[model samples]
Target: MSSTRKKSSRGREGSKNRRWSDRVTKQSNALDLESKIFKSTNPRRIALSLKRSAQASKRRKGTPYQSAMSMLNFYINRAGKSLSQKQKRVLERAKDELRDVFGRK
Candidate 1:
């Protein structure tokens, strides 16, 4: 049987990431993202960075907190297990700080 899928035009050979979500994470037009926005060790810093990105983005329709949390959750879900326990803890706390900074309960 023949496959109907067309070949991807992105990436070089032997690319392990063939998932569409990877492209969304990299190429999403949702916000003003800082490079390595998710790499920071400080929860508050990560939250604030996400908040800044969320607020500054013109393309997002949700409230800033929603956008920020969405992006944070996306990162947490996407980077699961690959993230160290310390890194995961930081990000989880970042969510709390994100709520605090946004005045959300």
Candidate 2:
């Protein structure tokens, strides 16, 4: 029988600067987020879309509310200093809207 060789790590990842967190946000086992959902200016729309996605996703690890909120927080936190003040405000408002949609007070 022929022996099998182990795979190499070199060039296995697409980019040198790529981080595991980046890959998780883009291609995780969680919800399949809408394209550019974070770019929306309307908070309610963002919340509603998140709710819909979370409710429909069987892959989410937490409750729909929890998963959606976590995903939103993850994007905001990951964006960090690069996120614009205006955009950040919109996203924060979306969190509030999300809570309201879920009736979580």
Candidate 3:
């Protein structure tokens, strides 16, 4: 019984270690966006800045409009769980404003 307990504890420790390693790897591989969306309270400014950043990135896939929209959506989705209802609404409006600024339908 003692040996079984020891094995179970070791297995738990091994899983914890693996999770930590995975987190480290994910952090290193993460994308660093230049827009700093969370720091700004104004939806229009956030949209403009994100648009500029997306346009400047040569590595971004698709058209300029598509790239900008993708970045904005990614930020919103990544932040959705942590953001308040008001914040989410602001971001949704920003998406609309971004489309307007980009001349997208």
Highest TM-score: give the candidate number: 2
Window of ten residues with lowest summed lDDT in model 1? 13-22
Candidate with the larger TM-score of 1 and 3: 1
lDDT of 1 by residue, 1-105 (tens): 898898777757546665655666667789777788777899999888888989989999898888889888987897453888898999999999999999988
Order by lDDT, highest first = 2, 1, 3
- Clash counts per candidate, in order, are 0, 0, 0
Q: Write the per-residue lDDT of candidate 3 for residues 2-87, one digit (tens) a residue.
A: 55533455666676665543343233223235434645678888778767766776775677678777666765676345678888
**Reference-based TM-score, model 3:** 0.65
RMSD (CA, Å), candidate 1 to true, equals: 5.5
- How high is the lDDT of residue 7 in model 3? 42
- Residue 105, candidate 3: how far off, in angstroms? 2.6
Cα lDDT listed for each candidate? 0.83, 0.86, 0.66
lDDT of 3 at 54: 64
Error of 2 at 54 (Å): 0.6
Worst 10 residues of 2 by lDDT: 12-21
CA displacement after TM-score superposition, residue 71 of candidate 2 (Å): 0.1
Clashing pairs in 2: none
